[model samples]
Target chain A: MKPSSLLAPVLALAPASAMAGSISIDLPRLPVAEYHRPYVAIWIEGAGIQPRTVAVWYDADHRGDPGTKWLSDLRGWWRVAGRNIGTPPSGISGATRAPGHHTIPLPADLKPGAYTLKVEAARETGGRELVSVPFTLPRTGGKGAGNGAGGEIGAVAVTLP
Target chain B: MANFIMFKSLALLVGASALALPMTASAHRQWLLPVATTYSGEDPWASVDAAVSNDLFFPDHFPIQLAQIKVTAPDGTAGAIEHGITARHRSTFDVHLTQPGTWKIGTEGFNVMGSFKVDGVEKRVGRRPGPPPGAMGPGGAPAGTPGGAPGRAPVESVALDAIPANAADLKLTEAISRNEIFVTRGAPTTALFKPSGKGLEFDPLTHPDDLVANEPGKFRFLIDGQPAKGLKLTVIPGGKRYRDAEGGYDVTTDANGVATVKWTGAGMYWMTISATDNKPTTPRATERRMTYTATVEVMAP
Candidate 1:
């Protein structure tokens, strides 16, 4: 028997953390009249696999989670992926941020596959914007990245390494 | 923005004098006129006449900015439209229809504001209409005030001056208007009707480009992808400089969020609907409102 075949089963038994990597997203500022930090939802969606939410930037710090009610307003994300994420998210959620670049590391449980990184943002009294970056996760360990733009979001660059 | 206010105010003043209406009442109409609805060839060049008229159908005879217009292809791609030639009564854009499906041509987010500052407090001026039912009620106001009609979604712009701007409060009045058109060549496509996620949207059960004059059609109203009921709709015939008091048709959606309307004329048609949430959880304005407008060219039998 080939030794590589024997090692294939051993590799399958290893934890997914052995393939973990990090992604950084650069977000530029928008010049609008009434500017506010956007409620951003970043996640990975792929064919035949459950969506993995990397981070959700919203007004979670608000009292009683009043902002959560508007979560459904995100439409595409909420209907396709967000609702699946349970309430009181332990670590995947955070507060909104001012205009600038930010980074989010992938979870250890992420498996190697073809996935799309999606970022959707909605601001108060402002338009809603969505951008998607397609990427491939290598088996061992590597990197992939892409970029786009929107009215409410600018200079959207995603890097997985 | 400044030009929009002037044109709108001019129309309002003219309508107010003719109808003997209150200063708070605004009567501006937006219309789209196509050189022809149906073409015989594969590639057709069309000139569309666009304007913000007075009352129901009369031409406003004012200048309209071309930057306010947008066009959507049959494949659902939306983009800004320029290269318009402005005349005395209307502005026109030349559209080359190369696709074999429906195209949506329209304009939105046109707003006019009248503001006054007092005591460092910037107060809104004009009429503050109540919110639509099932959404937010009138912000900080009683349920049924004399400010506006029920079933009418409050304009995105509010007139805090309805309470009268005194020494303590600044007064302002804002009016917003939106317009659109649905035109098709061969098969009908739903790409142009995608929900913007910022306002009320029309989910057409019957193809807008397929509607024939005097034929019945069905439509559904949606907000955030959910069926919304009790929404009011207005439909008006195109290519007119004036209209009677009962010129347009008005109807409200049923429990299933369906509104049925039959055509009466063989011309371009304008349909509009609006929804508003007056009480927002955010710290900004007390109301959030959205208005949707669409134009469809109905074929003549």
Candidate 2:
């Protein structure tokens, strides 16, 4: 049998330090009229497997309208994971973030493999942008950063321990 | 060579449209343009505008009759439209997308038109007062007198048996058309895309709601649930009124009835496919004409 299959169960029981990682995303403040907090989605996409979502910042709760209405504006994430998982995906969906840098914790128990961290952000009456950082799992200490075109997203960095 | 092929296919499209609406001077294409294709949140609603116009998506001609539209929800249950109003240029309605999957809003029409000879004079049998239901009328109210409305004549559709048996030169043509658009509330589902095994239908390889700009969207065309080979599909992006050129392209289906369309940009696209054949389900009709049109939105990647 493959080594990954044998290590999968042990890694599931491992402590957070062994498998935990974090993704820092920067939302650029744009000089545009009628600005709304952008809906952001971060996920990991690997070959030959379903995309695993790490965090989704959206308007989960709003007065008079469900903030989730614009989740599809995150086009890349919607095509991969948003459309499959229903609105306000448990444990992953949260309130929209302001225009600044924020850190999101990665999900534990990700199998050892090559994956791409995708960060997509879309603003109402504005623009949408996606940034991706490719990296390999089970690393000692490494980091990768991707920069967007500055319409919605800014810099995205993924660090693994 | 590519330009020549495109011109030929466009000519064929115009010819098919002329055959479909024989009375119209200009070819009028029908479509259902949704306010948005994808939506979310609780109690989400989708509003759609229905029209048939000379220019794609421009409500310049007339409105589609609201009586013919049918909404099919994700669970295969019947959904009804709210506040259906037919104006002079376009008809509008709202759908409450209560279910969290893909919903189909469309209309299907079937009619027979032909001529017969009586006393050496040829008389048409299927010419109604105005255009057929679900088609563009001559800049007025919706056609077909289903409800008891004044100043409108009832649609005159003669049955095959109603025609005099002794009449000579009996020729009948069957016209079948479908116009559709897809909207998803939260998650996109395929339950509504299942073919009914009749008429011109779509058996999509790529989900209709998942199309992206500059990406190839694969779709299969079926006539009576069989592959419609060598068919021509014309795709025109919306907002033709603002552009200097029409900016449309034509693609032909392969032997498997599949056509891959790489959308040029981000926006809603109006696609149309029309074909004619000798095969007709109606017993007396000798030729069958089929037209399928869809309004799909392509998002930017």
Candidate 3:
């Protein structure tokens, strides 16, 4: 089934309180011998099987669409959310970021529910790592955040503010 | 002058012979199969079909004894596999799945030995198991040097007059295979994916139990405890059906001993790493070659 058709209803039912909130994630630098910008896959895995992809930081060089092939290496998100969606999906995809903190704002009209922010990274000739943060978006809206760490991608956090 | 000319031609041919030869090792493939892919509900049970065959991808026939098999549950509890009915092609054994998670099923400690005879003396090669005392014929090579670890014996033939009188010549080959299957009664745990660090282990940094297709991931290699750099690991999505498919994933561990590969389509992936050394064992074969194999189930997209 197409992910858009499934997300359409949930997006429309989202309340106004969640609109002002943005889910920012911190992507820390690692201390490995070799370093490269990791292709990061950030998505929200809800109570159900389908997930809402927030962003894909990848090699957007687009010279011949070379980087698109390795995007699937983000196995967890690719299988569940990235495959069916458009390659770049315009706003949702962008060039990879250097090691530091980055933020992805939640959809203004997203429905309230429990979700796990799964952040996975993979780099060529480097290690792969995953960090997950569980959170909930109550319709009433307040504050929610979580943090995790990995080998390739260091400290990772998701915050709703 | 004529003899010198003939020797020069022979020397030139010998120097270029390797380039003209297609050398392939006479190697066998190991396989581990779970009766069913996934089991539901409480008290799930699993049984694996294990075999070693000359053909790496097919069970056309079994050519070697299975030797030993063990399964480590998700909780890190390990137990010898209780063998059940055996057939010409495979051996079946039960795996306890009292806890819900991925179970690491494996086989190790099997040696395939080969040897030769010179001057009426049979020299044992492969593994360190020495022949019985007084079993050697008079004037035969003593059962290896009676000192430090056995040294490598050349697999190739040596001149009879060149054979040492006190030490026997032998080459030892070892095999290790690791297979995994996931059982879900509820949530999965990290305990199921921990590495034993015994042989060539692929400690998944991507959580093997929850692998997803199109997901590029890394698995750290531990060969005999330390990081195994330059270890060759081949990842076949459908190892049993390898010949039936197209390109398979293959990589060598970096200096850090980590192999990274991305899953395209989901299926059962068989990853094998093999290594050899010229150094012989303490009491047995002249040289040793070791191999490790793992069967990973990649969940479909």
Candidate 4:
């Protein structure tokens, strides 16, 4: 019963359900002269959790662009999930994107249970990648959210027809 | 007569193999000038060759010398100014640019090896896509080159105000250890200069991969840009001097311009600095040079 007492009741039920629930992001495809459509970031976590950054994209003026300098090749989405999205609530204040495919949505006081999805890609002279996906949210009105180890085991699916 | 005594023992064996070599100066060495340390390959009037090797302190290896080849034009009309050069060897470090882009030739002589500088004309070495104040590569077609633009009237930019290039400094103050994974690159990273204060005294220990220790002072270093030399300077510490424990800071310039270097010793030492207008050509010196590079951390005193 000690992972620090299971992290003190999951940090007292994660800031009270950590904002209540919703998410979707599917980007990944490259090849156009080795590839030149990079600069992406998306966030959320809780599976070994500690990441929350919402969004980031770049290509503004293209001078060999490496944005945040290869964004750390996304190392397992920056250590299991962007160090748990440190400061994230909204997303990218500075925008820029071109090569295609991008979709963002996951806000509505997000809270329920299982949630960890992250993606990071950077390129100027080339290369970087990070990916993580998981889901399970139920209980805004209450009921639904199931999956031990707390969320995201598939490409990300939080079914609730 | 025993063939004239074997030709007098082959003339004493060819004068003892010409007195065992040595004395090999043979006129003006090469001078491609990328800050002059020996480089040749920029090609314009085409003819950049220098090799006075074994560093004699670059005064142009005497031998009927007179050299003078300056280019210095980073948007400041000191464009291609060539003058007097004897002791020949494929000659012509020329300079007659009406103007275009990137031109920093700079060379001088008192027999050879005096000045330095390179990276002239429409620059393009390889793989450099965004990593500065402004760089967004993949701009579509600049990959190989061809008539990108050229036809006179684009050569009147010489706003070099002699040397007052925004007082150089590259911050130093330590107290790291939240996780221990720091990084460095060309000190202060404005591409080797500019960090007199806060660009990053601490930003997650600055990690891109950090490894910019641009060798000691590199030599003849820059001033208006860094390690300057006219208003003279020598404050080098924009690198990881072995991760500082208290060892970073060293500036050098004296005779008047008051250049002193320090940082004593400690951890993370990748320190680099330069600023040369420190003049010295025997005609009583004072030509010009400008270098840069910054990385920080020093905490041992």
- Identify the candidate with maximal lDDT: 2
TM-score, chain B, each candidate: 0.67, 0.82, 0.63, 0.20
Residues B35-154 of candidate 3 have per-residue lDDT tens digits of: 544443334557777664444445554412334456667677874465565555677777656766566666545443555665646664333333332333333333344431246342
Question: Would you give the TM-score of chain B in model 1?
Answer: 0.67
Q: Could you give the fnat of all candidates in order?
A: 0.00, 0.70, 0.00, 0.00
Q: RMSD, each candidate, Å?
A: 22.8, 10.5, 18.1, 25.1
Q: What is the TM-score of chain A alone in each candidate?
A: 0.75, 0.81, 0.76, 0.28
Model 1 agreement with the true structure over B1-301: per-residue lDDT tens digits:
5444344444444222212222121444556766655432335555677765654344565534566667777876664454588776778887776775677777655232334445654443433323322233323222233444556433333443343335343322223335667665544568776766544678888877566666777888877677778988877776445553445777788887788988887666777776665533233234545566676766543
As for lDDT, the candidate ahead, 1 or 3, is 1
Top-DockQ candidate index: 2
lDDT of each: 0.58, 0.76, 0.57, 0.32
Tell me the spans in candidate 4 whose CA falls farther than 4 Å from its real position.
A1-129, A132-154, A158-161, B1-284, B288-301
What is the number of backbone collisions in each predicted candidate, taken in the order shown? 9, 0, 17, 102
Deviation in angstroms for B13 in model 4? 35
Q: Which candidate, 3 or 4, has the higher lDDT?
A: 3
Better of 3 and 4 by DockQ: 3
Looking at model 2, residue B282 earns an lDDT score of 85
DockQ for each model: 0.01, 0.49, 0.02, 0.01
Question: What tens digits encode model 2's per-residue C-alpha lDDT throughout B39-139?
Answer: 86667899999876777779976667788689999999999999899876788999999898999999877777777777876656664334333343223
Which ten-residue region of model 1 chain B has the weakest summed lDDT? B16-25
- CAPRI band for model 2: acceptable
Model 3 spans > 4 angstroms off: A1-161, B1-28, B35-40, B53-58, B63-67, B80-83, B112-122, B126-165, B168-199, B239-246, B278-281, B284-286
